[model samples]
Target: MTEMLQFDFMRIALVMAVLIGLTAPAVGTFVVQRRLSLLGDGVGHIALTGIGLGLLTGSSPVLGALVVAVLGAVAIEVLRARSRSGADVALALLFYGGLAGGVILTNAQGGGSSLQSYLFGSISSVSASDLYVVAALAVVVLGIVAVFGRELFLLCQDEEVARAAGLPVRFLSVLIAVTAAVTVVIAMRAIGLLLVSALMIVPVAAAQQVTRGFRSTMLLAMGAGVLSAVSGLAASFEYDLPPGPSIVLLALALFLAAAAGGTVVRRRRARRAGEVVPGPAGPGERPRVDAEAEVISG
Candidate 1:
């Protein structure tokens, strides 16, 4: 760790990784609660087209990605608000379309090069300018979440209730979507588009196993993500592996450990209480699934 810091680019990657690790999970907590986790992937796919265009034009791909990602978020919200198909369907359409367009454009302009770096990741690929752009965006994302914390929590709990209580669901929804887009762009630098959502999600999923408050989960997830980033980089440097995948693998291990630990704790608590405990939850299930259902029904 000390030796890697000697290089300027390594320092930049480390700083950017910490920023992305902290930021992704902060926003992801709300995203997971609202079941829009896949939105990250959809927006990333759309951002690819812009990244390709940027490469072709010899401009900053990150800027191109940010612009396209915001537009993708807008398109998603508009489609979602239209009552056309379900939210998942709308995201799926965008995901495929964006990927297809990105592939075509990139292939036409630049022989479809560097797709792997965009899809996977190369921490060394980030430059000082990339660091600045990501840092600025990270601040904006964190600020928005901080300022609208209450309203966003409400939106997570129930969009309709938030709307009924005059919380500006439409505006908040757009705000959150755009914020998520920014998160995706930042994450793309560390983990790449294909696995960026994992950074946003897996740590939060691990934190959820402990059953604290929503805010606690978010905090825990941030800690977990930072740990994963640092440790993953360490492992990659030691073993000559890819940084992003290594980080994601560590996060998965954490998630599994948390799930197993939570199961053991829950069973013990049930035994002490002299009540039969429910079976362990499936991978697909999340915390407050029943409450969210009630909110939906009501």
Candidate 2:
């Protein structure tokens, strides 16, 4: 820990991780709640083509990923709006196309020292300039979310109602999509393409297990993301584990613990409240009924 703090690269990696940890889950709560948990995955893959293009042109991969990810996210929203019923099909098509194109473009180009590193992340390789870009993007993404928090909550709760309430549902959704894409690109530096989606959704899921209110859940999820990334980075440095997967494992563990503990607490509360308490569901499952809510209602 001491040595890592002394090193600029480690410090940069930790800072980037913390920023992503906070930013990813903030948007991820809405993503998971809306059943769009895999949106980041598809966008991350699409961003790979951007990275390839950057490398081909001898530009920054981060720049490439940002532009491409944003465009891809916009395209997704456009396709969703156009197809309505076939949105999932369109997304799947985007995912595979992005992946295939990224590979062909990356290989056909002169190629970098290693594209695998980008796909899997190289947190320790972060530089000062990279850190600056990440910090700027993180601030912008978090700022957008902060400014429109209430609209986002309403939208997440139910699009129809949000629309009925004159909340500009389409605009809010597109805003979310663009923010989410920017978030994924930033996290891709620390978490990698394959695991970036997990960073976005898992911390939110863990927070959901522990918190009852949407507002609290959102805050807790961001906290969980930050803690997971920082602790995971420390552990990776101290124990010599790979950083990306290490951080993901820590977040997963938190989710499991939260799920089990929340279930036990709810079951006991239900029993005391004279409600029908069912057996705990599998890991990651939300209880069919909220025991505390039943108690309050009773």
Candidate 3:
């Protein structure tokens, strides 16, 4: 088992995992706060259309996917601008549209194998070239995230307030969406269209469970994502599981562990302060708060 870890395949997976770990949550933080977890799903599936087009034209699939994903993001913004309904409807339309386009194009061009890779992902088939592409995508993703960190936070906290404060909300929103599309494209290499959304959702969700502050949550989420990537890649190599699903499950396990630890700490502190109630929580029963009394008593 130890000897297996030193192989080139494992090494490539590790490098790819590191690149994915850093960018997934960085972009994911915004995606989560935007209430657009499905955005990744929508854009990722749409990316297949781009890959199909690329395969037909003998272009790079990654670049093609990136282009298609960005177009999808732009289309989303345009749709939101003109509509009164929620973004969910827009997402559904885009996803379905892209999926149909991809299927048709692939069938027409006789490139089912190439399209299959984009649709289902073939992480185990990753080559050194794929790693290089992912590394480049990581840099691009991180650059965009860093450049707009403040704007993203503003949007997340309160978009209306940000607009009132002259934060260019529309442009920022489009920028964030585009960044998410790019992240999804990069992650698709390892996780596939079916599961790439997990990379954006799991780590940040877990981090938010433990951290109240935004900075803390982002940092913790990034750490958790990196850990999951490393552990999951190792698991896939050792246990012959799929990489993307393994990473997601590892992340979920971490979340459960964190939740348990948080619960224990909160309860212990409450008990130590003699705040334990005599009976169990009732239906819609609120804890009787004696804030001033408790403070004085302490």
Candidate 4:
């Protein structure tokens, strides 16, 4: 790690990785609670169009992605809130349309080659200016999470209840969407738009395997995210691998390890209590770790 950090670019990449690590999972906790795992992917696709726009206009791609992504996120949340039956169809349209638009715009600007870095990531290519943009955006995301964390968690747990409790469900929902969009933009330079969602989600999922409450899950996920990001960046530098894939793969590995360890621990507890060990949770089943009882008790 010390050897890798000796260089200027590596130091910048390390900072970018840590920033991305901390911010992505912070918002991701609410996203997972809301069961919108794919929301990040959709926002990322739309952000690509913003990247293309920036390239075409000779402006900052990060700024362009932030604008477009936030707009798209609001639209998504509004549609999701208003049209339960057709939300999936609407999101599909946006996803494909954004991707197509980005491709056309990028090719028009003759930036097809340069787009690869944003799509797949090039951590070593991250510049000082890019680091500043990422840091600013990350702070914005973390600030939103810190301020709205409780309301956001309630909204995710049950939007109707949040509204009944006098919380602005609509506004908070849109806020989460916007926060997620900013996170995507922050991570794009180091992790790439295509895979940024994994960094947001995988750590949260892994943390869920061993945690018993929303707050604990969020904290553990952030730690796991940081570990994955820094370790994966180091590995990529050492082995000449791509940072994005390396980071994502490491998160996945952590998830698998956590899953196995959690299962063993749960079974041992069940045995001690003379209770039956439960089978694996179904897709629709929220794990016992995330049960409302657990969160409330905690």
Most TM-score-accurate candidate: 4
Q: What does candidate 3's lDDT look like per residue over 1-298, in tens digits?
A: 4765678877787888888888998889888988888888888878878877876788887788889989998888778666767766766878998989878887888877756656655556788998888898889989987888988998988899999999998889898888888888888877777778788888898888777578788888889989998888788777878777888899899889888877877677678657444345444545434443465467
lDDT, candidates in the order shown: 0.86, 0.86, 0.81, 0.91
Task: Pull out the clashing pairs in model 3.
Answer: none
Q: Per-residue lDDT tens digits of candidate 2, residues 193-287?
A: 87898988998889888687987988999998998999988888899887778889999999999999889877777677574445664455555
Q: RMSD (Cα, Å) of candidate 3?
A: 6.2
**Per-prediction TM-score to the true structure, in the order listed:** 0.87, 0.89, 0.84, 0.90
Please report how far candidate 4 places residue 292 from its true position, in Å. Answer: 20
Q: What does the lDDT read for residue 158 in candidate 2? A: 90
Task: Give the poorly placed runs of model 3, Cα more than 4 Å off.
Answer: 107-116, 266-298
Q: Candidate 4 lDDT, tens digit per residue, 1-298?
A: 7899799999999999999999999999999999999999999999999999998999988889999999999999999989889998999999999989998999999887768888878877789999998898888889998899889988999988999999998889899999999999999888888999999999999999988789999999999999999999999999999899999999999999999999988777667545433346556777763664454455
* Candidate 2 displacement at residue 55 in angstroms: 0.8
lDDT for position 193 in model 3: 75
Candidate 2 C-alpha error for residue 84, in Å: 3.6
| Best of the two (1, 3) by TM-score | 1
Q: Return the candidate ranking by TM-score, descending.
A: 4, 2, 1, 3
